[model samples]
Target: LPATLFSATVQTPWAGIVAQSPLVLVLTGAMWITYAAIYFLATSVFKRTPQDAAVLSLTVALPNYAALGLPILGSVLGEGASTSLSVAVSIACGSVLMTPFCLLILEREKARAAGENSGSTLAMLPVLMWRSVKKPIVWGPLLGVVLSAIGIKMPDLLLASIKPLGLAATAAALLNT
Candidate 1:
């Protein structure tokens, strides 16, 4: 899937089609935040610890979009429907936006439990966020977007080598269900 994402974002001229609107990205991020908030609040009524609430909320908030949504959407909607692009955007938004928020919640919970000042952790959030975004899951698609924007073409041999991995990802996803 990463290989296909790299190929599509770099080799194809579909950036405009993939990233049609900022609204989609905004809505995706908002949905995750709303879901997490709601889940956390709802779970709080159960008398669980902050960390437990954070974990429960995270499980409810993060969708299995890559492993489930992408394959189903590609098969059901067809590639021309821009499902791949939507999936890519969804992935990017989830990684960049949802992950940090969840981390913050978890970190706060930990600090509270340890009787430490969470203000220090909050102050370091930007650095922590930068580190989080450097993760391959986040940076891989980000790199693809940058390459696509610059009109850089992936090497044919590299594409050929990674094509199997993409195919295998799709196959494995389908078979797992």
Candidate 2:
């Protein structure tokens, strides 16, 4: 199936899925937030340093959703639009939101540890966020999303060119795990 059709089918079922139970969204959000909070509190209590707590919280909260979750979902559920959407949602949340949020926390903690003025950490947040946004992990999927939303079709040749790299990345991640 074409990428466009795959996306459309994924989106079609997603509305129904969401309509059937709004609780999924609520639960997902609450779960991630709770995980972050728990890790932050636990690490802070044990480490007794804001920087260490922030770093540990990130590791504890964020999982390798793309590499691991996608493969497991694919194997158990079989290939389908829902699986694709699930993978996309997991990747987007992990990369765009969680990674940047953790980075921000880490930066703030580091600043505090360095004895920077409190105001300076606040001042530095936008810069740190911009840096996070610019990172390839965040930017690549974001660009793909924007382009797809605008109905821009990627060239077949370009897609063909990147297929190997994507496969290689998945393989590398699996091997590392």
Candidate 3:
């Protein structure tokens, strides 16, 4: 997933997309609000466990934009549209902001289920954060962003080799979805 994210990031004109502040804000805001709504509803109204609520919310909120949105939009809009940027921004926001929250909840749940003496949420925060940071899904786009910001490019050979795996990841994700 990180490889896919890195590839998408390096390929997309993120700077140009980000320059359109309204698009960025709207996309980011919409995703976050959707996630929050589902999560709170699941936990409060539906009486789901935090772990279940987190998973349910993220699943419902984050779409498979790369597999579905990019191909369809590119085909219909004829390649030069802002669609790729929109998809990339959506993917980045979902991976960076939403995934970690789900991971943190899942990690806490895992520790609890295993009968580990995990402390209070505040005490567990550092460990949870470190675990989240180490995930490829979390760090992949982050590394991509940093490299792009510094004007460093992935060599074509590396991209070619990783392309297959990235595509496989996309297909698997689509199938799962």
Candidate 4:
């Protein structure tokens, strides 16, 4: 997964991302809105517990974009299209932001279920945020992005070695999904 994220980050065109920032924002916004709506409905209408509602909302809102979205998008957009850039950007946003938000909710719910006083939300915010950011899923792409932004290039031999592993990881992810 880290290898895949590194490749995707390095390969993605930063210029195209900046050019299509507006569309990327729209896509990210839509995803968050969908998550919020589903969570609200699940909690209020269905009378589900917070933990259950969060899980349902996350499952519905965040599809396997890497496995499904990229292929379909590449086909329709003829590959390397700006629209694909938008999807990539939105995926990054969801990974960095929405994921932590969901984790925070779920953790709080878990604590509540265990009858432990997890303290106020604001008090726990920073620790949860830090924990979430430390996850490989969050940090791996971020590291890639940071390296790419600074124009660092891995040796051809090293990248070659990693590419197959990345591809295999992609397949593994799809299989898991």
lDDT (10s digit) by residue, model 3, range 130-167: 88889998898777766766777889998898889777
Per-residue alpha-carbon lDDT of candidate 4 for residues 27-131, written as tens digits (9 for 90 to 100): 678878999999999999999988888878877887766555666687887777565565566666666567767877876766667776468878778766776
**lDDT tens digits, residue span 1-177, model 1:** 656656545553445635566845675767677766766686766777666776667557766565676677887998664676767666555554565566666656565676765477667577556655655555665677677778778888998997788778768877875
Residue pairs in candidate 2 whose N, alpha carbon or C atoms collide under 3 angstroms: none
lDDT of 1 at 42: 63
The TM-score measured for candidate 2 stands at 0.72
Candidate 3 regions exceeding 4 Å error are 115-118
Q: Comparing 2 and 3 by TM-score, which wins?
A: 3
Ranking by TM-score: 3, 4, 2, 1
Instruction: Give lDDT: candidate 2, residue 44.
Output: 61
State every prediction's TM-score relative to the real structure: 0.66, 0.72, 0.87, 0.80
The candidate maximizing TM-score is 3
Ranked candidates (lDDT, high to low): 3, 4, 1, 2
Candidate 2: Cα lDDT at 161 = 62
